[model samples]
Target: MNTPAALTLEAPAEHPFAPFVRILGKGKRGARNLTREEAREAMGMLLEDKVEDTQLGAFLMLLRHKEESAEEMAGFTEAVRERLTAPAIQVDIDWPTYAGKKRHLPWYLLAAKCLAQNGVRIFMHGGGAHTAGRLYSEQLLDALAIPLCRNWQSVNEALDTGNLAFMPLQDWAPHLQSMIDLRNTLGLRSPIHSLARILNPLGARCGLQSIFHPGYQSVHREASSLLGDNSIVIKGDGGEVEINPDTLSHLYGTTAGVGWDEEWPALSARRHVKPASLQPEHLLALWRAEVEDSYPQLALLSTMALALRGLGTPREQAFEQAQRFWDNRDTSI
Candidate 1:
C-alpha cells in the first residue's frame, strides 16, 4: 500500500517582521527598542510584504504605542530611500505632504509652484484621504491641472516638462499606503505616519516636512539630521506645510550639520478668520490674482521663504527672494 507515500511537510519559518513585533510587544519591561539597522531590516520586510498581515498590524500598533525613536525613523527612511525606483533626477526641494489640511487649502502647493516657476525643480509626494474630512494635496493638484505621476518614469517625465511633479505615496510605498488606509479601521495612526513625512525618495538637496503634532517636530529634526538630510520641519497650517499666517511657527531641522530652528512670528496683526469652508477654487483664484487675501498670500510668502532657506539661501535673503518669486510667478500656468 506504500503507506500513502510517507507524507512529508516542513514548518514555515518565522516571519521577518516577527522579531520587531516581539521586541515592541513584549510586556513593558521585556520590550526594547530596535537599533537603526534592525529598524531598516524590519521596514524592508514591510515594503517587501515578507510579513504576515497579523504580524504587520501588531507591529505597527506596538510601534505606535511605544512611540518611535529617531534611530528607528532614520532606519525606516533609509529603507525607503533604498527602495525608491525614481531615477536620480536633480530635485531642488523634496516636499513630502502626508498630513491633510482641514482648515486651509494647501497654500503650500502654490508655494511649490511659485518656486518651480522661478527655476527650482520641485518633487512633491503624498497620499490621499488617510484622514476623514481633511483635504489632501492630490485633490488640489488635480484641480490645478497638475498631472499625478504613478511611477518613476512618469515622475521623471513630469519633472522634465514643468520642473515640478507630484507623486502619490502609494506609487512608491504601497505597503505604507496600506497602513495609512487602515486609519479608520485601526482608529489610530501608526509610526508610518511620521516616517512617510521624511522619506525624501529622490534624495533631493532639501526636504520640507509638515508636522501636526508639536512633539513630532523634534523627532523629525533628529531623524533627518541622522540621515544627513538638509530639511525643515514645520508645524504648518493644519499640518500641511503652509506657514500659518495667524500663529508663530517653530521650525526645526538641519542644514550642512548646522542645526536650524526659529520661532517665526505670525505675519498678521490680528488673527485671521477661518473660512466657513475650504474650496480648491479658492487656491486657484488666489494664484490667478482674482483673489487678493493677505492671509493666503502671506502663507505663500512665508512657506516659500522656508523652501528658499532649505535650498541654501540666507535667512534674511530667503524671504526677499521668496517675495520676488511670488510676484513674478506666472499664475496662468
Candidate 2:
C-alpha cells in the first residue's frame, strides 16, 4: 500500500460566505465559530446573492456538520428580518410552519383558523413539500379557504378580512427558500431551516414556533431571548406547531426578555397513534362539524392553548379560552 500524504486546500479569497465556510471547516484546531457580527454579514451576503452556488452549498453543509451556534442563528435571523419587504401590518402572532406533516393531517390549521376567528391576527410563513412523502400546510390552505398570499399587498388584504394569511417562504424570502430546496441534495437540514423559523419577519410581539429535535429547543429559546421576542418553542408533532396530545411537551422560550420554560402534560392516557390515512379534507370537515374525530379536536385545542399562552394569556386560562374560541368559531369561513 502507498503511504498517504497530507494535502492543503484553500478557499477562494473573493467568495462571500467563504470565510464563514473556513471558520467552520478549517480542521479541528483552526476551525472556530463565527462571531454574531460575522454571521450577520455572511448571511446578508447570502441574501444578496453575493456567494456563488458552490460556495453556498459548501457553507451550509459545513455549518450543518458543526451544528449552528445560537449566536450564529440569531445573526442569520436578523439578516433575514432586515431583508423582508412585508408592509407594516398589525400581527398578533408570528407562526412559522417549516416542518411539513407526514403521519398526521395538519390539525394545527384548524387551530390557527380558530385563533383568527377569535380576532387574533396571525402571520404565518413556510415552504411546501421540500421533502418527499410530506404533506405541507400550503397544500391544505385552499381547502381550508385560507388565502395563500403571494405578495405583501395580498397579505395585507387577506389579514384585513380573514385576520390570517399564509405566505410561502419562496414569496417571502426567496434566498432562504432556495437553501431549503437544497434538502434533497444536502441529505440533511442546514442552519437555514432553524434561521427561517426565527425570522419573525413582521417583528410580531409573540411567536409560536417548533423544531423537530429536542436539542434545538434551547437554540430557539436562546436565540429568541437574544432577539427579545416573546416566543415559545416546542418539539411539535411531525415538527409542525401542532401539539402532540400523547406526550408531555417541554416548552422553552423568553417572556419579555427573560428566559422561562413550561411543561405541558399530555392530553390523553391512551397511547398516541397516527391515523392510517391523512386526509386533508378531514380538517375542513372537522371544522364544519361534519367529522367528529376526538384526536384532531384535542390537537386543535392543545395547539391553540400554546398559541394563547404565547400571546400572553395566563397559562391556566389559555386552554379554557381556546376551547371557548373553538366552540364559537365561524364555520362559514
Candidate 3:
C-alpha cells in the first residue's frame, strides 16, 4: 500500500539569490558583509532582474540596517559600470544630483552652468523626484532651458553644443532607478542611493558627491579610492553638491588613489536664514543680474571653487577663477 518511489515529488531547490540574503541576514554571530566578488555577483543578479521582490526587499533592508561598507559600495558600483554603455562623450566632471533642494534654490545649477559656459564640460545626472517636498533638478530643466537627455546620443549632442547635460537615472539604469523609487515603500533610503552617486558612467575625470549624513563622507572617499576614481565628497547644503556659503564645510576627496581631507571656511561673516520657499524663476533672474543677492552669489562661487579644485586647480586660484567665470557668464537667458 505504499506509494511508488517513482511518483514521489521532490522539494524545489532553494532560490539562487537566497544565499546572498542569508549571508547578510544570518544571526549576529554568523552574519557578515559580503565579499567584493560576492557583492558583485549579487548586484549582477539584481541588475539582471533575476532576483525576486521579497529577496530584493530583504537584501536592501539588511544592508541598510548594517550600513554599506566601502568594499560593498565599490563592488556595487563596479556592477553598475559594467552594464553602462557609456558614450564617447568627454566630460570633465561627473556631478551626481540625487538629493533635491528644500530650503534654497538650486544654486548649484547656475554654478554648473557657469562652469559649462567657460568650457568645462559637465555631466550631471539624478534620480527624479522620489521624496516629497523637495525641488529636484529634473523638475526645473525647462525653466533653465537645460536639455534633459534620455539616451546617449542626445547626451552627446547636448554636451557638444552646451558643455552641460543632465540625464535622469531611469534613462541610463532603469533597474537602479526602480530601486530608488522604493524609498517610500521601504521607509528608508537604500544603498543604491549612495551607489548611484559614484557611478560616473561616462568615466569623467572627476566625480562630485554630497551626503546629508555625517559619517558617509569617509565612506564615499574610501569607496572612490578603492575604485581608483578621483572624487570629492562633501556634506553640502541640503545634501546636494552645493556648498552652503554661510557655514563652514568639510571636503573629503580622493586623488590618484589617495585620500585627503580639507576644511573650507565659511564665506560669509554671518549666518543666513533659510528661505521660506523655493522659486525656480529666481535662478535665471539671478544669473541675468536682474536681482542682486549676496548669498546666492557666494553660494555659486564656493560651489564652483570646489569643482575647480577637483579639476586640479589650486584652492586660492580656483576661487579666483570661479569669480572670473561668474562675472563673465553669458547672461543672455
Candidate 4:
C-alpha cells in the first residue's frame, strides 16, 4: 500500500526556549526551578529576542506561579548585567523604583534627594506606569527639578552635578521594559518586576529593594548573596523602598556573600491614617518644609535612615545622620 501523505512529512523540531518552559511547567511532580545555568541561558534567549510570544507568556506565567528561586533570579540578573553598558560614573546607592506609590506620596523620592544633597550619588531607575492609580517617580521628576536622563551621557551629567539621576528602564533596557509592560496583558506581574529591582546595572556598592509581598524579602536577600551583592530588602510602605514609620519593618540583607537580618522598630506608637489622596505636590512641599506634616517627616527620615544603613553605616548613626540631613536640607529647591 502507498504511504499516507501524512507519513511523508517530518515533525517540527522543539523550540530552543521550550525546555525552559518545560522545566517550570512539567506538572506538580516533574516541575522544578530552573538551574542557574539554565536560567541564564533562558533569559539570555529572551533578551536576545529569540523567544516566541507564546513561549514568552507561558514562561513568565509559569515562573510567576512557581515563584522564582534565588538561583533563577541570580542567573537572570547575570544575563542582564552582561548586556548592560553601565555608565563610567560611580554611584553610592542603587535605588530601583519599579513599584510606584499607591497609598502615600513617594516619600522615598524626597529621601533620595536628601541623601543626594549630603553627597550620596544615587542612580534611580524605574519603568513607566504600567499599573494604574500609582504615583510614579517620573511624574514627580519635573516638579522636584530632578534631571530625567534618557541616555548615559545625560546620566553622567545628572550624577556629576546633582549627585543623583533618574533613568526610566525603557531608556536603557528596552527588552526588559517590554516585558514589564505586559503587566496588563498578563493580569499579574512577572518575574521581571523582582529581577529588575536587583539588577544594580551600574554595579553600585549598595542595592536597596523593597517588596510588598511577604517571603520574597528573603528570596531577594538570598539572590543578592548569590550575586555577591551588598543589598537590603525590606517590606517597605506600599512596596516602594520607603520605610513606614507606623510598622515594625524587617530588613533582609546580604553583605559579601553572607546573609543577615535586622528589624527596625516602628517610629510611631500608633498607626497613622492613610492619606485620602496621594498628592505629588506634597512631596515638593514636604521637601521645602512649606507643610510640616509629622507623618511625612517621619516617613522621609526613616526611609533615609534605611538607605544609610545599606551604605554600611551603623544603625544609630544612620538614623542620626538621616535626621541631620533632613534638618539641614536646602529649602531653595
lDDT value, candidate 2, whole model: 0.87
State the displacement of the C-alpha of residue 305, model 2, in Å, after optimal TM-score superposition: 0.8
Provide the lowest-lDDT 10-residue window in model 2: 11-20
lDDT of each: 0.85, 0.87, 0.92, 0.91
Clashing pairs in 1: none
Q: Which ten residues in a row have the lowest lDDT in candidate 3?
A: 1-10
True lDDT of residue 21, candidate 2: 80
Instruction: Quote each prediction's TM-score.
Output: 0.92, 0.94, 0.96, 0.97
Candidate 4: stretches off by over 4 Å? 1-7
Q: Model 2: residues >4 Å from true position, as ranges?
A: 1-16
**Could you tell me the TM-score of candidate 3?**
0.96
- The digit string of per-residue lDDT tens for model 3 on 1-333 reads 987578667999999999999999999999999988889899999999999999999999999999998989999999988888876789999999998999999999999999999999899999999999999999988877788999999999999999999999999999999999999999999989988998899988899999889998999899899999999999989889999998889989999769998899998999888777888888989999999998899998999999999999988999999999999889975
Choose 2 or 4, whichever is better by lDDT.
Answer: 4
Model 4 error, position 132 (Å): 1.0
115-137, model 4: which lDDT tens digit per residue? Answer: 99999999999998989989899
Residue-pair clashes per prediction, in order, are 0, 0, 0, 0
- Candidate 3 positional error at 8, Å: 5.5
Tell me the TM-score of model 4. Answer: 0.97
For candidate 3, the per-residue lDDT at 4 reads 59
For every candidate, C-alpha RMSD to the true structure in Å: 3.7, 5.4, 1.6, 1.5
Which has the greatest lDDT? 3
